[model samples]
Target: MPVDSCHFRTKPIHRNTLNPMWNEHFQFTVHFEEMCFLRFAVVENNSSQTTAQRTLPLKALKPGYRHVQLRTQHNESLEVSSLFIYSHRTEEGPAGGATASSLVRFIQVCCF
Candidate 1:
């Protein structure tokens, strides 16, 4: 994702032992609008002696879309990102970014 000119290239975390709250993942390897899958490993980093892993595979999620949110069981968040098919060329989604006032107005209009 592009953030303040830091254009990033995302890659799937093949084996990461993350908090239980993290479910969704972003797959950025495939060509834009193409299908890809998520593969992950849940690990506990605090333990010093041993290696542990929990595999979470993507069975059936819609293609051309990615939604990832990393959060801890305590509701603490680490990171979040997503990519989706709007056009074949990579671009930001509609309403992807907005000011607080604009978002509030949008919410109001949608609700009203």
Candidate 2:
């Protein structure tokens, strides 16, 4: 799967396996989660031909491990497992403290 114009990519898993374990960690610096989306593609490793692709909204996702049922271009169903974690850093003052008002103002300025 790729996100944000191919800026992030997960390691490929083996083909024809009932259960594949990637055990990989991917980190992304997300500024606008509302506008961000995830693109999944199932491509042939050797031929490089895309067999299936799907786009999903980021904000609609929930945290923790889950199963994603994807649809191919031909509208066939495919199941995949995934884990999602979302985190953001809060801006701190010179004294290294973040106030509630400051965080609210930051969200208003950025999200609105």
Candidate 3:
């Protein structure tokens, strides 16, 4: 079976009772029944790794994005099960850049 689309999300797994001022970290859990694919720094699965998810200054995360890629057991890019998602880190997380990013994809039906 070929790879399909995956899901993404970011949730703060913490309690308010604790001091909010303390540094808060984001722990991402990715699961794929088939194998692993690329994790992106952008919505279109672009960019490389970041500080493993952490609290950054407003300017640094001004236009923050994440990407990830999962490698199959055989370490083949084709045998990829991929998932991607993107969200504005904050209200002023930079938007409307006029120059829109490009995207490329090819949907596979099946093998003959």
lDDT of model number 3: 0.28
Among these predicted structures, which one has the highest lDDT? 2
lDDT of 1 at 46: 50
Q: Which ten residues in a row have the lowest lDDT in candidate 3?
A: 103-112
lDDT of 3 by residue, 23-71 (tens): 3233222222123332322111234333122222222222233322434
Report how far off residue 7 is in candidate 2 (Å): 3.4
TM-score of 2: 0.57
- Indicate whether candidate 1 or candidate 2 has the larger lDDT: 2
Give candidate 1's error at residue 112 in angstroms. 28
Of candidates 3 and 2, the better by TM-score: 2
Candidate 2 CA-lDDT value: 0.48
lDDT of each: 0.28, 0.48, 0.28
State, as a TM-score between 0 and 1, how close model 1 is to the true structure.
0.21
